[model samples]
Target: MGAFGRNHARVYQQLQQAGSVRLVGVVDPDTARADAIAREFGCKSFGSVEQMLTTHSEVQAASVAVPTVLHREVARALMEAGVDVLIEKPVAATLGEADELLRVALEHKRVAQVGHLERFNPAVRATLPLINRPMFFEVHRLSVFSPRALDVDVVLDLMIHDLDVVLTFVKSEVKEIRAVGLPILSGKVDIANVRIEFESGCVANFTASRVSTERVRKLRFFQAGQYISVDYARQDVLVCSVGSAVGAAHSFATDANEWGTRPSVNPQIQMAKPPITAEEPLLAEIKAFLRSVRDRSRPAVSLEDGRKALELGLAILAEIGRHAGRIAVGKG
Candidate 1:
């Protein structure tokens, strides 16, 4: 919700281009914002979810972009109205709310997708094919501080992205998790790092900061025989593997010293760097949503996936609190 609503509107417009979906209506508490989006998409604007559902009977699906605290109310209303939902991530502020949403969606037989946009990133798609047996992974996502999402900690707003990605890659249960964070610009923790140990013996080290010098979004995979790095910003993939090769002869002159000798150096390296093709991930995500709507198939990022990401994020937040308590006691 918040600025993310703008992205939801844009993605909906892109979905219209495929002729499978249409922007039926837009809703935001801010009338100006809702009107602006409606005008841009040639749709009607409603100031409340209740009014939107009542006025737009043709809306079979909705993009719920409300704040975390209001997610349960809005999503439940939409699901009860027989509309599929695509809710923005950290599905709900609390596990109870997320679980209730899941239950209602199931009871109503509605599709509730979560917006984890990284799953649609082209780099992720390209890297998925190359990964054989990932033993370890690292990710860093940093952004300059903004006051838009001060209600939630950095783990939910920032670290959850990497958590979803790691969970997708490992596909195993988490054995343990350790996290530490501190508040900098906002009352909530603005910088956080987490270490997750999966039952598959794979570990993921992740760091996310909303207060940073510059934005950095990257992931690294260390698997057997190779290391892969994907720079989401640059859309670049670099693969390094072990190789053996002979070094080219170097021309050297040792005239005065007879004992001077040239030592042979082994140059064993081969690097294959490929330019990653850029595609609009939001467009792909919306297209998938449309496909799910039409075919009644499961979403790429389903409600269950969102629940897991939220659970891990909440666990990290709890860990942060525990660490903070330790520091307070030490100071006393």
Candidate 2:
């Protein structure tokens, strides 16, 4: 759909190897990129989405990897043309645009998947087993400064990944939110922090930075008697939980009349073993989309999921603006 169209082509080719789907065509406003991808993937290339859909009747689905601003238009066009779509995340630049795209998908009765590839990550899947009634969560996603994603702030660019994960674990509506952001490198906010309180009484603290000196992607979850940590980049999960023997030990001490004789000993902690790593998440995501298309099933990340992440990202941006205004007023 745009500059990152090449990645979509590559991932789709991998999915084809996995015996799911094949790439039938490529579309980009830039002829050079479009032609290059077409040659590499052995598919037809078109200068625009309209031309591609009009000329190709065999294409049953599309991966709309366009810019945030053009997401709605390209996705709506594909859905309106009766082609299922896998739209890259943040869905669209605005919630209204995302809503319209969803409406179009419903009108056409086609699948509209969102590209939240983290959902397919092996480490995230490993951590999923440990997520039970999380009381608190902390996430940090930092990346070395990149000029490629200057169109959006850090909240949309990075924080949304953790936000989706948090929302998945909490399984509740957000009751309150507070955020702050500033532009240290890019003109738009390059670093941001957000605190979200869910109706289930789970609190999440998230931080994202696109102007960092180093890159790190990690999340930690705290529950009643356990802690879970996930390292997305390294594909690792660490769990620390209190052992069941602790309660038995306490009961024995009480029977011995040692209730107040000594301070309560800490519960023994246990760690779970790591899980096997899987294929690339982007490739898995593409395969999932193709399977959904063929079986007429829902996607792993649906249009509504993308819309909720976008809404949360936009709300964080609004909160940042308000915080910045307060800071400016205080300085003046």
Candidate 3:
């Protein structure tokens, strides 16, 4: 467990109390770090996944929270042992690694999950029923400078969540990608802007920055005659509609605009706040993973889904580099 691993450990412990699964063991290469987190969560610690699995053969499922590079190795070992896994986001460091993880999971028939926590967000779940030909999206995920996750750029660390969500929503092939990024506080790209066009003619613009002064996480989209907004931090969703008056306004729709009292060209507007049952996204993800393991069913965020997100992330990184080279040549 490193920066985000403590949170994973905490959620697993919470899951232990709330359900049938138990937190059997936590493994870390650093014995001290593993012991500290284990003690905090009332679980045992081991030097590695092998040691843990050797001692605790009853372990059926695990959360692979290792670093980006170690994901393939850690997850491969677990799956090979016939254990289901919920590997954390970015799935793997590269597309090849991601594909291998998927292959192993399939060959082992293990329940594999990708840690796209936002997929379980109450706001996102609530907004799903409201989707209808989403034409455009504007997403922003900003955070104040943090030393954690500096190993990778903001594209993988922060923007990938939105990328996964948008890809799920659009369900279309990416046709074009234009991106720009620069390093600020870290050696990796600390801030980035991306514009993606999909085969469905949908367009999305994303902005992610780890060197921001304020924290903001929100996504807003426009569809045909409707606008929807999602607040990730607050777990809230707001849907505004045009050309379709709903609920109580349905009775008055035909009266006002049709009687010549108002312009017929303008349609009555309606706004609705979809009801949401808010829960910790991580907890929900763990619960879902455990359920998948027990039932041997596909996870909500499957390996293929994670791979697609990683592919897009890698593509965006390449596009950023290409743009940087163009800018440098122009400057020269």
Candidate 4:
């Protein structure tokens, strides 16, 4: 386990303490790193997946936090051994690899889940009830420059999270994609801006960057008679609604100061804050994976979902290339 892998180990330890699941062991090619994390988390360490499974045949479930390129190999080994797995984000390095992963899971009948962490964010979970036929969206995910996650560009590394969420919320085919991206600090794209149009006549704008001066993660959407704002880092959702409250599904709390009495045509704009119980998203994701493994149920974010998001991400990268070609022609 590296940095993110260590975080996964930590969450699993916490989960075991809560009596949700058992922390079996951590595996990594680096024996030094694996042994160190195992000691720190009070779990066994193995230099390879084969050794781990050999020593602990009871590992019913595992989180494949290995590199994207190695996801297919590691997860296939786990599933081939009768173990379910939770593959980390960007499922694989390519669509073909993702398809192979799907095939392996199907053949083994394993409970496969994708680690789309944002799907388990408290704010996102809270915003589920506020969903309507969302017509428009504005999403921003920025981070101060860091060396982590540089294996893939900002699109696959960061924007894929929002892509997964939006694809789920929209539940429609992607109609068009327009994107522009360029690398700054890393050889891969470190900043990107994209617009995705859905078949349902919905549009979303996404900005993702890893070379920012500050950190921000927010998603806002507009639907009929409502505007929703979600702060992912803060784990908060704010719903501001206008128009008559007739036949509204969610009752609005009346407080003059909540939205501040507006003058003129805008009579009343009801604002509501949904209650959210905060928990580490990794813990939630792991617990959900274990539950699915135990009950023979589908995961919250299935492999199909991961494939769809990866397809969209690859599409975005393609569009970025097309746009860059046009710009280069002009400069030439």
User: Worst ten-residue run, lDDT, model 3?
Assistant: 245-254
How should the candidates be ordered by TM-score, best one leading?
4, 3, 2, 1
Point out where model 1 deviates above 4 Å.
Answer: 244-267
Local distance difference test scores for all models: 0.83, 0.84, 0.89, 0.90
**Residues 89-170, candidate 1, lDDT per residue (tens digit)?**
8799999999999999999999889988888888887777787767788899999987786778989988888899888878
Which runs in model 3 stand beyond 4 Å of their true positions?
243-267
In angstroms, how far off is 93's CA in candidate 1? 1.0
lDDT of 3 by residue, 25-128 (tens): 78899999999999999999999999998999999988898888889999999999989999999899999999999889889999999999999999999988
lDDT of 3: 0.89
lDDT of 2 at 114: 93
The TM-score values for the models, in the order shown, are: 0.90, 0.92, 0.92, 0.93
Candidate ranking (lDDT, best to worst): 4, 3, 2, 1
lDDT of 2 by residue, 1-332 (tens): 45466788987776677667777788877888888888988788898888876778778998888778888888888888889999888899999998898889888999989999889888888777767678789999999986876788989988988888787778899999999999998899999988999988788999999989999999998876678888888888888877876644433232547765645578788888666566688877888888899898999899999999999999999999999999999999
Backbone collision tally, model 1: 0
- Stretches off by above 4 angstroms in model 4 are 245-264
